[model samples]
Target: MTTPLKILISGQHGQVSRELQQRLGDLGELVVLGRGQLDLSHPEQIRQQVRAVRPDLIINAAAHTAVDQAENEPELAFAINARAPGIFAEEAQALGVPLIHYSTDYVFDGRKDTPYVEDDEPNPLGVYGQSKLAGERAIREVQGQHLILRTSWVYASHGKNFLLTMQRLLQERPELRVVADQIGAPTWAGSIANSTRALIERWLAGRAGAWGTYHLSAQGETSWFGFAQAIGEHLLANGKPCAVLQAIPASAYPTPAPRPLNSRLDCSRLAREWGVTQPDWHSALRECLAEQG
Candidate 1:
C-alpha cells in the first residue's frame, strides 16, 4: 500500500505540459497549475504554489516560448523565463523535491558549424535566448536537485507550432521561401515528455544521475528550409494541400530576430549522464505526424 507520487507540473496548457501529464499519469498523481494558479511571470506564485503542493517532484513545463515575440516583450520574457524558475527552484529546495526544467538551443549564437554540447558557451542573440540563459544560470546557482534539459523545435498536435504552421502554409500557398541558415533538431513534444519519464524512472532506479544540463534535441539535424520541405513532402503525398515549390536559402528571407545558423546539439553527454538516447528526428517526426492521422 504505497502512496502514489504526487508531481506538481507547471504550464498546464503548454505543448510539453500536456504530453507530460498524459505520460506521467500512470506513475503519479499530477496536479497542473495554469497561469492563474502559478504564473511564471510572477516569482511569488511559483514559490507559493510549490510550497503548498509539497509535491514529490516539480516539473516546470512552462516557459516564455514565443521566440520572435520575446524581442518586443523583454521584460515579460525575463520575468517568466529567467527570474520565475529560480524562485521555483528555491521553494522546491525547501521542500526537498526534485525539479525538472526545460531550456532551448537559442542559448547558442550558432557561430560554430557543429553540434553544441551542454558545456558549449552560450551566446544568445535575442531577448528570448538571453532570458532562458539567465534562468539556466539561476537554476545552477541554487545547486539543488534539478535537471535542466536544453531542447529545440518543440511541437505537438495541440499547439501552434512549426508543424501546424507548415501544414497551413503549404495548403494555402503555391510556393514557399524558407531560410536555410538556421539549423536545429526538430524535437517532438511527445518524445521530450516520454524521454523525461524515462530519465525520471532511471533516477528512481538507484542510478547515479548528474544534476546538470543536457542537450535533449532529437537525433539528426535540418535547416528550417529542409524541415519545411520534408513537411511539404509528407502533406502532398497524404492527400493534403501542399506547396508546389519550396525554395531554400538564407538570403531569400530575413526576420527581426537573427536565428542561430546551427541548432545541432550533441547528445553524447545527455546519454552518458542521463542514460537515455533520443530517437532520430525523422522517426520522431513521422510518429508525431501520424499522431494527427
Candidate 2:
C-alpha cells in the first residue's frame, strides 16, 4: 500500500488554511502550523519547523494581509510575506519537496483595461504589494519546484473578510460607502482550497510539469460596491435586515495603500492546465451563505 502524502500547511487559522484543513483531510496526513506553533516572521523558526516536520509537500497559506496597515508596518509585512516564503522554499528545496505558495493580485497597478495574465509586469502601488511581489521573486530565485497561486479579493463565510464584515456592518449602519472603481473576483476560500487539492492530486500522480504560477479566482469580476450590494441582496432574500450600500470611488475612501482600479485576473491557464474552473462570484457567495445557515 502507498503511504499517504505528508502535507505541511502553514497558517492554521487563516481563511484558506481553514478551508484546506477541511478539504485536504482525506487526501493526506496534514500537519498544519499556526502562529503559536510556527511564527512565520522569524526565519530561523521556519527552518527549524520544516526540518522537524520533514513532510512530502509544503503549502504556504500565511501572509500579512493588512493592505493599509502594511504601509505603517512594512518590516512586519516583508518579514512574513517576502522573507518567510523564501525560507520555506529553501527548506523545501533541501528536502526535495515541492512548495505551494499563495500570492495576491496587488502586485499589479491595475492600469490595464483587461484582466491580468500570469506574465503581466507587476508595478505595485504599496508596501504590501511590493512585499508580496518580492516574495514571489525570492521563491523563483531558489530554483525549486514551486507553484505560486495568485488570487484576489478572497473571502469566506467566517474570518475577517469582506463578506462577513459586510454582514455585520450592514446590520450596524443604516448606510455604508464601498469602493466602486476597484474591480476583481471575490473568490471563495473553499474554491481555492478545492483547486489546491486537485492540483496536488495531479502533481502526486506524476504531473510535475504543472508547477508554475497560475491565477485562481472566481469566474467573473465586480467592484467592492457591487459585491456589497449583492451581499445585501442575498441577506434580504434570506429574510435578514441589511444596510443601504452606497457606491463610491477609491478617492472617496482614502486608504494608506492605494488600491488597484482593476483586480481582475484571467484564469484560463489554471483551467487549461489543471481542469479547474471556479464558480461565478455570485454563485459562490450564495453557496457560502447557505453553508452559514
Candidate 3:
C-alpha cells in the first residue's frame, strides 16, 4: 500500500488558492495555510512554519496580485511576490520536497505580438510584473525541485475578477467601457486548478525531472471588451437579466499600473510534456458563471 502524498497550499482566501484546495482535496491529505496562519511578508515565518509541517509538496498560491496597487506599494509587492517565495523555496529544499509556484504573464513588456513562452526574455512594464518576475528568478536560483507555472488573466466563481465585475455591471449599467487593446487568454482558477492537479500527479509518479518553469493558460485569446461582451452574451443566452454593451479603446480608462498589451501565453510545452491541456477560457468562464449562479 502506498501513502497518499501530503501537500500544503498557501493563501486559502484567494482564487487560485481556493481552487487548488478544492481540486487537490481527494488526491492527497491537504494542509492549507492562509494569511491568518502564515504571512508571506514575514519570510522567516514562512520558512519556520513549513519546516515544522514538512509536506511532500508545497503549492504557493500567495502573491501580491493587485497590479495597479503594486505600482505605488512596490515594497509590499516585493515582499509578498518575490522575497517570500524565496524563503518557501529554501525551506522546501531543506525538506527535500517539491515546490510549485505560480507566476503571471505580466512578466513581459507588451511589445511582442506573439504569445510569450517560458524561454522568452522578460521585460516587465510595471512594479507588479517586475516583482512576479523576481519571484520566478528566485525559484530558478534555488537548488530545489521546483515548478514555476506561469498563467494569465485568472478568474474564478468567487473573488472580484473581470467576469464577476461584468456580471454586476451588466445588471446595473447600460454600457461598459472596456479596453480592446489588451489581448490574452482569460484563464479560470478552476481550470488552472485542474491542470495543476494533473501536473502534480505526474510529478508524484516519479517524474520530478520535469520540475521546471512551464506556461499553463487557456486555449483561446480575446480582448477585454470581447471577453466582457461574451460574458454578457452568456448571461443573456442563459436567460439571465444582463444587457450590457462594451466600448473599445484603451484611452477610455487608465490606471497607475500598465498592463501588457499581449498576454497570450504559449502553453504547448506543458501540454506536450505532461499531457496537461488547459481548458478553453470561454468554456471555463461559462462553467464559472453557471457555478457562481
Best by lDDT: 2
lDDT of 2 by residue, 146-202 (tens): 999999999998889999999999989989999999999999999899889988888
Candidate 3 lDDT, 78-176, residue by residue in tens: 999999888889889988888999999999997887998889999999999999999989988897989899999898878879888888888787666
> Which 10-residue window of candidate 3 scores lowest in summed lDDT?
202-211
Provide the clash count, candidate 3.
Answer: 0
Clashing pairs in 1: 183-263
Worst ten in a row by lDDT for model 1: 245-254
Q: What is the lDDT of candidate 1?
A: 0.87
Q: Model 1 misses residue 155 by how many Å?
A: 1.3
Runs in model 2 deviating more than 4 A are: none
The CA lDDT of each predicted structure is 0.87, 0.92, 0.87
Candidate 1 residue-wise lDDT, 1-293, digit = tens: 13478989989889999999889998879999988777788777777778788898899899888888999999999999999878878888888878899999999998987899888889998999999999999988888999999999888878889888888988998887777768888899999999999988877776847888888989998887778888888987898878865556665576667778888999899788878989998999899989888
TM-score of each prediction: 0.96, 0.97, 0.96
Residue ranges of candidate 1 with Cα displaced over 4 Å = 1-3
How far is 138's C-alpha from truth in model 2 (Å)? 0.6
Query: What TM-score would candidate 3 get against the native?
Result: 0.96
